[model samples]
Target: MRPYPSRSYQAIFWLVFGGALAYCVYGLIVGDLYFVGKSGRGAHLHGVPAWCFTAFVTFLGAGVWMREFSTISSRYRTRFEILFLVSGFSLLVLGWNYSP
Candidate 1:
């Protein structure tokens, strides 16, 4: 496979992908937020804020856009990039406001 013309694009792709994955793992390990334990009865886990869920979805979408940004055809590349930017910032803002 040919390399993307821009090294920076590749870097961005990996960064977003890795960041999203790490975030997921972190959430899981924390166990009180998004991750749930199967311990029987009275699992009084604090309800996660809606913004946290929104942020997670947006972050994943941004990662997808980053991964496909250079692979898609030119016609759709711009659209995807726009989606990526919008989602990325949406994720950021939602995350910033997120609280258990």
Candidate 2:
């Protein structure tokens, strides 16, 4: 495909995407203030349980892997990218619609 029309735009996208992935990854590990463990009170920002948030974060890992593969055009590892995109979307749904 064609390179980004603007290098700055691409840079911004990378920053945002990567940052989001990083945030979620870190959140999964840190959990939350009140939510200390499985028995603790897990908070829900938009409706998603903190545990589910962690699950969604795993998708970012896939996105990161795909980004590395795509950067070098290594064979057909594009599936990771697709997985990332789909997972990200699913995250939004869980975040917004999850009631329990």
Q: In model 2, where is the ten-residue run with the lowest total lDDT? A: 43-52
Those runs of model 1 whose alpha carbons end farther than 4 Å from true positions after fitting are 1-16, 32-69
> Which ten-residue region of model 1 has the weakest summed lDDT?
42-51
Deviation (Å) of 10 in candidate 2: 19
Candidate 2 accuracy as TM-score: 0.43
User: Candidate 1 lDDT, tens digit per residue, 8-80?
Assistant: 8768767876765666555546655344457755322223443455355555566465556456666576677
What TM-score would you give candidate 1 relative to the actual structure?
Answer: 0.43
Model 2 bad stretches (over 4 Å): 1-48, 69-75
List, residue by residue over 1-100, the lDDT tens digit for candidate 2. Answer: 5452467755776777677666665665666413334775664342245555655656765666466524646445576677776886687567657665
Report RMSD for candidate 2.
7.9
- Residue 33 alpha-carbon offset, candidate 2, angstroms: 6.3
For each candidate in the order shown, give its overall lDDT on alpha carbons. 0.57, 0.59
